[model samples]
Target: MSGSEQAPVVGVSTYRQRAVTGVWDVEACLTPAPYVEGVTRAGGIAVLLPPQPADAAVAAAVLDRLDGLVLVGGSDVDPALYGAGPHDATDPPQRQRDTWEALLVHEAIARGVPFLGICRGAQVLGVALGGTLHQHVPEVIGHHGHRAGNAVFTPTVVTTVPGTRVADILGDGVTAPCYHHQAIDRVADGLVVGARDDDGLVEAVELPDHPFGVAVQWHPEEDLDDLRLFAALVDASARRRTGAYA
Candidate 1:
């Protein structure tokens, strides 16, 4: 295939796991299969990026080879990263994943790479950009509608802000599969709210100056029917790879 026709490489962040798969319990780097499926379905080369050393150089090297990034959903962000104390409902933070993904977020921003962050990944993007999180959505909303239970994907109606990229892509009044317990509290500088739920909770955000930097509180990967978000990232990556952004 010609260089311009090559599929854009999209890197996806993974979760570290300790699982018993057979006779032995082992530590492993893993990501949800749906994330890969979504990226591949969007015509991009999906590359799993497991957590690495918390070094800027390493993160930069990894980003240098990719055209786009997907920060997959996982554990809660460490409150300390946003200068807040953890709430009782907050899950124990995954410090290692936190450190590594934070580096990736920084590098991706510095390099102007297109990225999509889902759930916890969205929180990471927010914190990395000097934003704070709600810590516990139940406390603010007084309901667990956003996350009915563990391993459950609750459906919620989210309205996109008119004229925002999210509205342009998903249109207004979108019913999305959501399973998040925390939400952005203080939106970061330069990032604008792209969508929100009926409760007026922030559901999505975008960086106006970025080529394609969007993060959503819902798990788009769980919604197999809609590949628009993933496709947007891939399209942005393809543009970057072919100098369309120039």
Candidate 2:
């Protein structure tokens, strides 16, 4: 390997289609540049996985090739996926993404693949593990300060549980940038809280028994200055590739 060679590759979610307001046909495979750029900056390769045909077999094959999985933040997951009644704020899910990423999360977890999920990614992880969601965190909990409208990408103060995976990586707390209107309500069968807000929302989940699994209700990828997270995931992926993360 050359002096500048990078480590094992990691797969990330892609935005292939989306619903603008009430319209659902405006397709887009969008993603924030920082996801790829940050991974590279941390000496890891980034691979994009579109949200379609993401079957268990396909995911196992991909997991075999890659060392880690990163779930990027975007879109509102269908409230119905978690057995919730119709949400007044429910937006049409990017069906293409819904099926694929959901499958990817299940397959990755089943195969013991190291993984990290951000924002909507965190919500998906919960549902995939047979849990539920509170379609709108503020609507039910009335944690009005959790989300700031108009300029949706405001910051929230998340206090992590001491000794949890997140606090161990990002210190005892961090002010993460959030844009999502939905959050995990049911604590999932295989996941546990790594942090929470004053409102008692599940701000993060960690698979304490899995090789490496963690999810956060914020856009950690958007903050390039937070290389601790980027480095942690890359390090986990490298361990997975070397068969040391088991």
What does candidate 1's lDDT look like per residue over 80-150, in tens digits? 99998889888898888999998998898899999999988888999999999998899899999999986
lDDT of 2 by residue, 96-203 (tens): 677788888888888888888988889889988888888777787766565577756768788999887888998888888877778898788868799997677888
TM per candidate comes to 0.96, 0.90
Whose lDDT is greatest here?
A: 1
Off by over 4 Å in 1: 2-5
How high a TM-score does candidate 1 get? 0.96
RMSD of candidates 1 onward, in order: 1.5, 3.4
User: How well does candidate 1 score on lDDT at residue 183?
Assistant: 96
lDDT of each: 0.90, 0.80
